[model samples]
Target: MIPLLFENLSIENQPVSMPLPNGITLTIKREDKNHRFVSGNKLRKLKYNIAQALTEGKDTILTFGGAYSNHIAATAAAGQAMGLKTIGVIRGDELATKIDVNPTLKFAKMCGMDFLFVSRSDYRYKHTPEFLEDLQKRYGSSVYIAPEGGTNTLAVKGCEEILTPNDAVFDVICTAVGTGGTISGLINASAPHQTVIGFPALKGEFLNKVINNYTNKTNWHLVHDYHFGGYAKVNEDLVTFLNVFNKNTHIPLDPIYVGKMIFAIFALANKGYFEPNTKILAIHTGGLQGIEGFNKERIKKHKSILDYEEKI
Candidate 1:
């Protein structure tokens, strides 16, 4: 059944006029409309991963993510739908705390995923052989390991399908760079005449190295100035942008990743980054359900201000 979803899916040509705050127009690809694989960029990445696991005769899959990770939820759903077992290695030691279990984690549990808690110190070594060996010892050796955020060579190969049906010419293809897997795949799949722009949603140079490590070509560029205070962090400007973007485009973008990337793309295009006639394709990686707990957490954390605000 899971394989059928991949076979029956078609990448919809989501067309929209992306307007910047400064009054510039850019054409955007609305990948969020492709809802077969939980919508957007994740669907493409998971297609190949799931297929590979099946091909290898692996019945169980293990991956890493944070408490609010969309990757975790998607993996669980994909596993259940495909008749495979899913294990999530969550970061941090607060897994037992009820308040720490966000909506994404809750849904992951409902999807029948087994959860394992790890310390922050150990999370840094998630990709190490020793850590994987321990997991194998516990969960059996048939389990396939997927890197955090599904950012690996195989993940990139899956993402390459994002541009397969593109008969239209594009000047730039833009996407949010988390582990850099999507952007790396975009670069690999893009026509030699096209350019790929990646917006880093996290601060620091970590993603730069990730991209460099996976990709050898230089057609892709990473922009780091518009993270909106790092991953999962948002402000009034971001909220305002998201509200307007959804109202205008009818596409809901999670503030942490896709929203930041869209925000940066518009900001850059407004500054004349592209020729007036250049077409830009922006990939929307879906994580809308992840926002349910995020907003609740924000309100709880800022109870003082939220209590006095006009009840919407």
Candidate 2:
């Protein structure tokens, strides 16, 4: 057995110190430090999925995502660590030639995951029977498919462990939403006295429908205003916040997910969003490996550049 996934990675709740208008207390659930490769919510999402794959006697794992997807990189690393083959159905065909240039894909390639790059139009059909069948034909029957972002019932079950009995004291539990998998788990785990909020990384109305299909919990809410622009879209204000927050908390956040969620929480807190003495717990979903690509996009804005190790 690949031994890394068998380690008992501990989770910590670190308190955040900041000036707020109300008497609001904030803490972060440090899920990112769970593992070096399969860190953050990814580990939670993949825990049982990998078990199921093994129980089914699968020797290979197949999945889909964009070039910079944390899910793709995590899947590749996990499979290699677990002694299984992995295949990634990447969204852009042009990216096939840029594996060396893209940090996330570069790591996946290093872990021995093969790539099958497809056009954006073709990627939209990934869930359809025909597209999945084509994948099976190419990768063989030993493949176990992981839905993009590792969102599924098993993932939800793993994410529910994020909220311990101690978390019940917090009035609100917050996390960044990708495919609604992480939030769905939080919603399922939240106490009746608590509210779980999903701060989406992208602007969309369909998340409710997708999340609703997972859980029947009514204590959850989606905050749509914090996406900045859309998925992977970042502005100067956001870049500044990411840097400042890391400086203040010594915690790194990926621009796509955790960065935006933290920025929103601080802004709302400053604007008197929470009631006096409200307790909030922000989930630090890890995607720190994507900072290389994010900082490359900000090269024109920032004179300094961070290499891979330095970013980590």
- Number of the predicted model whose TM-score against the real structure is largest: 2
lDDT of 1 by residue, 194-253 (tens): 888888888888777887877788888888898877887778777777777767766677
**lDDT of candidate 2 over 1-312, digit per residue (tens):** 324584466789999865556788889999998888988998888888888888889999888899789999999999989898999999999998999989999999999999999999999999999998888888788999989999999899888888889888899999999999999999999999998888999988999999999899899888899898899887778877777677777778888899899889888888877888899999999998888777776686764433322358
Off by over 4 Å in 1: 18-24, 99-101, 165-167, 303-312
Best by lDDT: 2
Q: Model 1: how far is 141 from its true place, Å?
A: 1.3
In model 2, what are the clashing residue pairs, if there are any?
Answer: none
Model 2, position 34, has a per-residue lDDT of 88
Query: Against the unseen true structure, what C-alpha lDDT does each candidate score?
Result: 0.76, 0.87
Instruction: Report the error of model 1 at residue 266, Å.
Output: 2.0
Query: How does candidate 1 fare on TM-score?
Result: 0.89
Give me the runs in candidate 2 sitting further than 4 Å from their true place: 1-7, 300-311
